[model samples]
Target: MKLKLILSILFVATCFVALGQEKSPEKGLIKISIMYPYSEGKTFNMEYYETKHMPMVASFLGANLVKYTIEKGLSSGIPNQPLPYLAIGTFYVKSLSEYQAAVAPQRDAFRADFKNYTDVTPVILVSEVVK
Candidate 1:
């Protein structure tokens, strides 16, 4: 009886682990944070980023835009740092590699087109789902 119980426990544990692995959420989401710096006398660049650049990226990437936000910073208490405007784009996916394959072409096209405007480099950070 003890032997049977031990074997059953082990089998249950193994099944749980396998099921957990298959449901891993880290393979499903992405977030990109865009930092728009304080460019003196060129505020149009910000608008350009919003109107021209962003729409192109969104249409091209074809990924679900979970949330896009602008984070405004404070200047007075933040030392000498210029208060940069930020745009965050969240992407959800089924697999990381799939996400990459989907976005690569659009990224290349955006890079090429970005030369016509100011250097607006984006920092990409990704995450997955849970449960």
Candidate 2:
């Protein structure tokens, strides 16, 4: 009776502790991507995005930033279809918390710089690598 209750309590406590532990990233990395979907009349400046925006992001993110990659969309599945996205920029970070902490401080500055490259708003995705 009492032993059963004690065991139940212990089990619950163990679960709580496990849940509180930090989540590990896939291959020690968490990837954050920002995508700009193509639209008529939408404009993107690839040169500014490559030369300026990424370097600024790296500078602000600092040590937490593992690396970043930028992709230029060429085409969609159909032979002559327009690309789904104008560009996709991915940021690989050490961990979710580290990335959050690093970006929080510089978020405003980061967002402000977007106008220099493109007019389209980006869709952001954060994914955990599964290895």
Per lDDT, the best of the predicted structures is 2
lDDT of 2 at 123: 99
Put down candidate 2 lDDT per residue, 52-112, tens digits, no spaces.
Answer: 9987787777777888999999889898888899999999987788778877988898889
Question: Model 2 off-target regions past 4 Å?
Answer: 1-28
Which residue ranges in model 1 land beyond 4 Å of their true spot?
A: 1-29, 36-44, 70-77, 84-95, 127-131
lDDT value for candidate 2? 0.87
In order, how many clashes per candidate?
0, 0
- The lDDT values for all models are 0.58, 0.87
Q: Which ten residues in a row have the lowest lDDT in candidate 1?
A: 85-94
Would you estimate the TM-scores of all the predictions? 0.50, 0.75
Over 84-127, each residue of candidate 1 has an lDDT whose tens digit, in order, gives 54334344444557557766867678778666555555556565
